[model samples]
Target: MSEPTTGPAGAAFDDFVAARSTALWRSAFLLTGDRHKAEDLLQAALVKTWRRWDRIGHGSSRSHETAEAYVRRALATTYTDWWRRRWRGELPTGELPERAGDVDEAARAEVRHDVLTALAALPRGQRAVLVLRYFDDLTEQQTADALGVSVGTVKSQASRAMTALRSSPALTDRFGDAA
Candidate 1:
């Protein structure tokens, strides 16, 4: 389709981006496990979505859902493509410092760090599967659709992901002794 021009379609795309970019960024961050990469991933998805705005079921009764599905698919596929290309190479420096907030906030940040670190160890497909299935709360079919895989693939990926997470020493140590 032709690119969305600087008119009604462009305006609609702008409004959608303004309203949904933050949530999309969170999802991208979960998929990528990095702030800078997540920003780039979301930006690339937005650009692709803008290019296809007119044909993306814009302003339909379920416009929000349709647009999100399109952009999310772009995010997932592009992330996988990047993995195949080995675009990112550097390892994370360390767990981020907890923000100077309440005690509870500090604990939550630590837990989040542990979880994300553990997630980063899994293979790219398994990580994507878990993020889509559990984090995004998508159904098996929906997750499969988003990742461009079959339902069986989704199930297997989720099963393997959970097994890997269960065996992660860092994750177990973080919450294992708490209970």
Candidate 2:
């Protein structure tokens, strides 16, 4: 009997991570809208992907794509689960929280922040759709697969998300007539 080979698979996993980690992290950050949360989200997704790496990495022509799809799916599902769980424990308070730090109006980063803020205001599924579709450039079917939803769901979410962003005063100001 032949022993199972771990060396090539491990190397392939490593290569996949090295090539795709940054892009995946960026998607996680867009989904989370917070750097700390993004890091945690990405780490969780990576751990889940690593656990299933061998199975995902051994396919035919689509092995690399399969691995990426698995990781992306993990990120989307984990973020949705985390958001639900986090909100479940929050106590509703009548008092308004402290304001965030003042932003410099002249800085482009502030405008970018405004766009992100608008993005964060979206529902979790819509936000995931935007990230998977626009940020990661996944096709509608791919986005649907990643989120474990039907293609119709992906279309509706993307449409609603775009409408929300376009109507958002913050984003409208950032993009002006372009929005």
Candidate 3:
């Protein structure tokens, strides 16, 4: 991803960043299962969205200046493109040594890690569907629009992704045992 250059339209971009970057980064971590990778993903998505802010933020109605939709769309597109091209293996979400000091911190970290690993194991398109539908609490049509796919695709992706997760050993051990 390229660096963010300066421009007059940057105010809207800046507003978006100030409002949403942290939550987006958190969602990114869940989607990516890596803090560093999530940061990179957030920066890349932000840059891409900022580049198009003018057209998106043009003097139009509220629906036209949809920053959330734009960012989500950029993230889904970037992630799907990268996964298609690279097909990277799942990132391990096992607790890192960095979490050793505090018990409460470690437990929270562990849970986040397991969930992320479980989620990231899905195909990128499916993972995007999951993140948008569940993590972002978006509707099927919202996810479909964000991913540039169809509502049927979103449904199938979520169903397939959930089936895969339920059968996954990590998820079974971490969450299924409670069922």
Indicate the TM-score of model 2: 0.83
What lDDT would candidate 3 get against the real structure?
0.76
lDDT of each: 0.87, 0.84, 0.76
Instruction: Write down the worst ten-residue block by lDDT for model 2.
Output: 90-99
Clashing pairs in 1: none
lDDT of 3 by residue, 51-107 (tens): 767666633346233877888888778876767788556644443665546899877
User: Residue 86 in candidate 3 has what lDDT?
Assistant: 81
Query: Per-residue lDDT tens digits of candidate 2, residues 103-133?
Result: 4533656666788879978999999999999
Stretches of model 1 off by over 4 angstroms after superposition = 87-92, 177-179
Which has the greatest TM-score?
A: 1
Pairing residues by index, what is the TM-score of model 3?
Answer: 0.82
Best candidate (score: lDDT): 1
What is the descending lDDT order?
A: 1, 2, 3
In candidate 1, what are the lDDT values of residues 1-179, reduced to their tens digit?
69978887788888889888998898899999889999999999998898888888666648878898888889999999988998467764766676666788888888888898889999999998898889888899988999999999999999999988888887888667431
Clash-forming residue pairs, model 2: none
